[model samples]
Target: MNQLEALKRWTTVVADTGDFQQMEQFRPQDATTNPSLILKAVQKPEYAPLLQQVVAQGKGAEISALMDQLIVRFGCEILTKVPGRVSTEVDARLSFDAAATVARAQRIVALYRAQGVDTASRVLIKVAATWEGIQAAGQLEREGIHTNLTLLFSRCQAIACGDAGVQLISPFVGRIYDWYKKQAGAGWDEAAMAGDNDPGVQSVRSIFDYYKHFGIRTEVMGASFRNVGQILALAGCDLLTIAPDLLAQLQAASGDVPHKLNAAAAQGMALERVHYDEAGFRFALNADAMATEKLAEGIRAFVADAVKLEQLMQAAAV
Candidate 1:
């Protein structure tokens, strides 16, 4: 079996893209999209019409409303291709507003329902891992709206999300590696940090071991892979959301992709359970410089793309 096929035996491979056309090629079980990916997709020739159609149909409605429609439209389209579920992210600007995040998540779920989607089973509202976002996800979960907590960096964030009883948490792998590598500057040894020694890989492994040790029900889905090595290092994570480019590379490569992270292995690990209240959560996140900077940077980047998407919708409206 190819590496992709080999990995699937242990992990549920998810396509991390807004371009549904690319998903069929990898045959990922589920798909994920953020404002950035959706923005990138709608700018393409094939997807440009999707934006135009939403603009024309949402006449006089608020632009934000139309923006939600556009994302749900993409989610609906993606659902038709993937069998499991699709993660539609909330507006990143609301990452710190629990009320607004909850409101937006509700609307996104409502819109998916209007599309005849089995919202309860097929949709995961992706929220940032901020304290407010985690609280918002807890609220949504109580209402039977499953959530995927994205932009997760620190173990504290994962602990809080698990406490919130979220359906899943996406701890970014590439961004963490990027931060450490840049911090190391000239002293960074690429080969030494490539595989199991990779900081990013180690981050996910730590979370996985903790979750399994404590029997935290929230699923750990590793996201934002920088290289195939990172993905391979996390072979048995609950799921790994990978970009199409890396997915293609995995599909082509032939090798022994071992089960690197499994419950059995994690159970054998000596890990202490951690619970983070709001104050504790904030302090823990603040203490980690990498997590603090990357979390804020990720929110800003997503918010910028969300604004750009709105601008595109406004232009299409005219």
Candidate 2:
């Protein structure tokens, strides 16, 4: 079997794209989208019509509402292709605001429900893994809305999300790798950090080990992978959201995708349980320079794309 098929035996392969057309070929169990992915998709020639259609329907509505509509429409389309959930992210600008995050998440879920999608089972509202976002997710979870906590870069963030009783946590793999590699500069050793030793892979492994050790029910979906090796290293994760290019690479490469992570094995390891209150969480996050820098960078990038998406919508409205 190809690596993709082999990997599927151990992990639920999720297509991380806003392009539904690409999802059919890989047959990923779930799909994930952020502002950057959606913005990229809507600019494509084939997807331009879909954006125009959404704009036409909500011609005079608030741009933010129309933006939500467009993303939900994409999510709904993605739902038709995949049998499992689709993660639709909340606005990055609201990442630090608990109330606003909850409100926007509710609106996204409501939009999906209006289209007859099963919001309870088939949707994961993606929120940034800020303290406020985690708190907001806890509130939404109580109301029966599932959440996928994204932008997670630290174990503290993962613990907070698990404590919040979120459905899943997406600890970014590639972004962590990027930060460490840039820091290493001339001292970086590509071979040494290639697979299991990769800082990004290690981050996910640490989070996964902790979750399995504590029997935390929140799923761990490794996101923002830099390559197939990172994906292969995390073969047994609950889910791995892969971009189409990497998915294609996996599909074409024939190899044995071994299960590198085992929950039962992780449970046997010595790990201390960690907890974080509001002040503690803030301080913990602030202490990790890499996490702090990357979190801010990721949020800024997403917020910029969101604004660009708005500009596109406005131009389409005109």
Overall lDDT per candidate, in order of appearance: 0.94, 0.96
TM-scores of all predicted structures: 0.99, 0.99
Q: Which residues of candidate 1, in runs, are more than 4 Å off?
A: none
Candidate 2, residue 144: Cα displacement in angstroms equals: 0.2
Native-vs-model 2 lDDT? 0.96
Candidate 2, residue 216: CA error in Å? 0.4
Candidate 1 lDDT over residue span 46-113, tens digit each = 99888888989899999889999999999999998999999999999999999999999999998988
Decoy 1 TM-score against native: 0.99
lDDT of 2 at 250: 97
Cα lDDT tens digits, model 2, 1-318, are: 899999999999999999999899999999999999999999999999999999999989999999999999999999999999999999999999999999999999999999999999999999999999999999999999999999999999999999999999999999999999999999999999999999999999999999999999999999999988999999999999999999999999998999998999999999999889999999999999999999999999999999999999999999
Which 10 successive residues of model 2 have the least lDDT summed? 253-262
